[model samples]
Target: MAATITNTVIDLSHHNTKPDFAKAAADGLQGVIHKATQGQSGVDPTYAPRRPKAEAAGLLWGAYHFGTGSDGVKQAEHFLKTVGPDHASMLLVLDLEGNPTGPSMTLEEARAFVTHVRAVTGRWPGLYSGHYVKELLHAQKDPVLGQCWFWLAQYGPTPVVPPAWAKWTFWQYTDGAIGPGPHEVPGIGACDRDKFNGDAAKLTTFWKAGGV
Candidate 1:
């Protein structure tokens, strides 16, 4: 059987703050859709390998903003400028987790930002958050998000994606991962590995089509 593209996302955020990044990425899986923060300074050194490795493996590569309360368009521009245009991410994720805690946005405002990201990037931008954020969006009522896909991070053994949210292309099932890295970070333990539903090509199209 051909190898399945059970894509993982590596975040550069401190493991405690964002525990899934290293564990998921270094799982030595087919493709990875890692994220990097923008608008402050430069790209993250840890997440640096995510894009190159994906490209090298002919695997799906994607990136997203940490959603630092910046306007979606500005964030998109910052990502493009930093990562360069050649690195075409299958999907651009707007991590909608931490924003609402501070001088961030409400669910309604966050949705608008997501739309703006899609408009500016010319690709489907996805939403990355836990169950609460999904609930906040009331994903059922406001379903059609152009071509965007959802990169759900509701950690568990089963696929906890809300049915009303439609098919989720990427499901992060666990935080236990182990591997080498761009920095000397501890791995997240062992990964479950059987959860991915799509292949690389599917992932690519899914990403380009906004993860729909």
Candidate 2:
């Protein structure tokens, strides 16, 4: 299946079984955003180990934290510590989706998390969410969160972008099971795929700028 966007990105976690970053790059995959931590306790375990391999394969690397009901400040601390420093071009993200097993993070908590991230990193992390944020921030703009780049997660024909931002910085079109075609990637089958709202050069700049 072919996508309208030229720059493609794939997000992964412990749930993803195998990840051949070299093959994924050969298949036109430009980047990988893997889960880093959850709440203040849970760590992805695979995040650190996979970082070098993904980068060595010539794929842009990224790390994201799954927000929980725990203290956002604490979660941010744990997340950054787990992911280490960005070094230069590594992308950092905050997954703000509604959690099933644990309590979902409130909008206030979400704000705090991003704020702390910026405080530590000197750059706001990309925010990843779907209907959870869509409904939560319907027609309203959060001053703090708005500073962070939006990573819309909508498995549909068109993304129902939140009103806070005019458009999405990165749109998660599929999660392997839903959204558009080619839900599976070359190395990692049946995973989340994202479309950057820019060309290859712009995507590289976005990564280097952290969230431009």
Candidate 3:
């Protein structure tokens, strides 16, 4: 069956302060995905501590790695080492964005990074990228990478899933401040808001299934 898309979620990093995950959950967020590592060496300082807070809030917590397009295997190794094997019940995302100071990654490089992470974690890492990057990856027609789930990033009223994806598992719809009235998020100011492709129960199932 095609997944039902409705619930809201949020992705945060060290750029934002320690959030009140309980308040966020009360405010209608179903899950939280945090930036755990960047490149092959950079680690988010808040991830280790904040992750537990998110979990305690009864939110499905996940982690992502910002790709540098360098050595995919080593980068995956770094991410695995940092997040550890305990994340079997949560999502694993590969954040593929344009690096302002680095060269763009070829499809092979991207696939290698994702595949290596999957091999180590035994969970398929969801691909998170904007439209252009998604299109580029789609053109490669990679069996391994193309089979993974997608988290499409677009800032508008409606999110457009890339043609390569059968369906988008997550959609980041707003990077601006959003909430009831002008309050932005309860604890996080000017955050990226997202929509899970399913409801709360399905999200819990997805998390337990390791994102399939």
Candidate 4:
């Protein structure tokens, strides 16, 4: 049941430092998703600075907000304000993992956040999580959350797709040391890597469509 990686995309934040987008492009990296904001107050300082650089390298750009225990609508507003207009080319995501910094976001809050995001952006943001999501959502079906594309975060051999989603759109198979190899990218030595469910052209279309 282990997933095979196509190595077309990657996701990063300030934690991985600045990457060499030129090298990454040469390495066949098609897109890059980075952390834009975390909670209401937290923002990734590197978000705006590296965007054009990544685009210059011909990599599709994306931003994700790490959900926190706050007013979901306000969080969505803050996330959109930070990310700017969608323009139909940039991917937007909701990171639904446990919040180590504070209280984790409840399913209710996440529902509100994603719904508000869809209401404002005219599209549903992708949802990124792993075991936490599986545990919470395994037995339940969420028509609202299910509308968003599922980005599976699994470091193990095989990933679990929650009952709400039929399958995963993107799989985060590694976080540097875990999951499958070749974990090293051209610019980044060891960082987060993901695989799309299709070929290069499909991946491009997916990115261009903002994971629609």
Candidate 5:
């Protein structure tokens, strides 16, 4: 069955402030996935501190790596080393949007990267990308790539499930500021907002399933 989409979450990076995770949690966020590393070299300085703080505040913690079309093995190594095996209790995502200014990842590169990360971590990292990129990659039929849980990014009133996906595990519904409304969260100002496919109890069960 398709998991029902509900619950609010947020993602952060160096671009945002050192978040007041307590404030975020009090504001009712279920989780936070932060940028851990990018390409083969860049690491988010805040990730080290923010991770523990987010956990302390009772938010499920996740980490993501931005693909730069670099050596897949090296990039995966950097990501794993930075986020560390202990900290990723919720999910590890492969930010597969590719470089905005440069070329996006080819299907082969995406597969290689995800494959290497899964080999090392023993868990398949969730695949994150926009709808267009999902279509470009032909994700539904690619044997190696299709195994990942999809985190679809589409800005709209409602999220559209990507091709071949029964449902998306995570949906990045907006990059705008979350706010004055009842659903507007504090601490995370003008950042990307996401939705889990299920409610809190279901999310916990899904997390415990270890990205299966």
Candidate 6:
């Protein structure tokens, strides 16, 4: 069987928007995908346009929250509310770029926050952030998210997985795309065939098991 290439969140800001890009690239895809947020806590009006394009091309969809000045948990709550969690393929994502406004929380606190949100939502929200951030947490072996599948954002040839993070289900490789919009992970072409790791049945089973 061919390995599935499922890069969950594609942030279509200044980068991915072009003439007929989203509408074009929606062909030959599988599993749930998300539109990444940009500017002032992820409330861009472009989501409406991007989503229909993907849906037209046959892709299950959702939205991802790029974190800002607020606490991680609070940011997550806002994202969940903003996107709502009952779509065809609903998966909330927490994008942790850095602590620009508020004081950075300790590793313990960050992990705890992730765990708390997962418990509350009953879904395994994804983590999208830099390699350095993962490395910092790796040193401490963050207990809160040892098993979470990472959507790593590294614009390069090969993705470097932090030792602490063992499994990497998705890797966002670049801000460029070939035929259409900016691909969430450009190097996904490096993989054979693309599909989500778990089908709806598997996702539902995981949810019931409280694995998120």
Strongest candidate by lDDT: 4
Q: Which stretches of model 6 miss by more than 4 angstroms?
A: 1-10, 18-26, 31-42, 99-113, 177-212
Per TM-score, what order, best first? 4, 2, 3, 5, 6, 1
Q: What TM-score does each of the candidates earn?
A: 0.65, 0.95, 0.89, 0.95, 0.88, 0.65
Residue-wise C-alpha lDDT for candidate 6, range 94-187, written one tens digit per residue:
5666656654444444454467557776556666666646756665555566555566666665566666577555566655543223443432
Candidate 3 C-alpha lDDT tens digits along 1-212: 86577656788999888688888778877778899998889899999999888889888888999888688888889988999878778888888888777765556777888899777877679999886576675554558777779998877666666666777788887775442222256766568877787777887788778898
**Candidate 1: TM-score?**
0.65
What lDDT score is found at residue 12 in candidate 6? 45
lDDT of 4 at 163: 91
Model 6 alpha-carbon miss at residue 202, Å = 10
Candidate 4, position 198, lDDT: 76
Error of 6 at 53 (Å): 4.1
Model 1 per-residue lDDT tens digits across residues 100-206: 44455345555665666656556557766667565665545455442355666755545566554566656665554522222222343343222355665565565
- Residue pairs clashing, model 5: none
Candidate 4 positional error at 209, Å? 1.3
The parts of candidate 5 lying over 4 Å away from their true place are 1-3, 138-140, 177-183
Looking at model 3, residue 206 earns an lDDT score of 86
After superposing candidate 1, which stretches have Cα over 4 Å from the reference?
Answer: 1-28, 38-42, 48-50, 57-59, 99-101, 138-140, 143-147, 177-194, 199-201, 204-212
Evaluated at residue 157, the lDDT of candidate 5 is 70
lDDT by residue for model 4 (30-90), tens:
9999999989878999999999999998889999999998888888989999998754788
Give the per-residue Cα lDDT of candidate 1 at 203. Answer: 55
| Highest TM-score model number | 4
Computed on alpha carbons, the lDDT of every model, listed in order, comes to 0.53, 0.86, 0.79, 0.88, 0.77, 0.51
Q: What alpha-carbon RMSD in Å does predicted model 5 have with respect to the real structure?
A: 2.8
- Per-candidate clashes come to 10, 0, 1, 0, 0, 1
Q: Could you tell which candidate, 4 or 6, scores higher by TM-score?
A: 4
RMSD in Å for all candidates: 6.3, 2.4, 2.8, 1.9, 2.8, 6.0
The order of the candidates by lDDT, greatest first, is 4, 2, 3, 5, 1, 6
Model 3 is weakest, by summed lDDT over 10 consecutive residues, at 176-185
Candidate 1, pairs of clashing residues: 11-21, 90-207, 124-210, 147-210, 148-210, 149-210, 149-211, 176-188, 177-188, 177-189
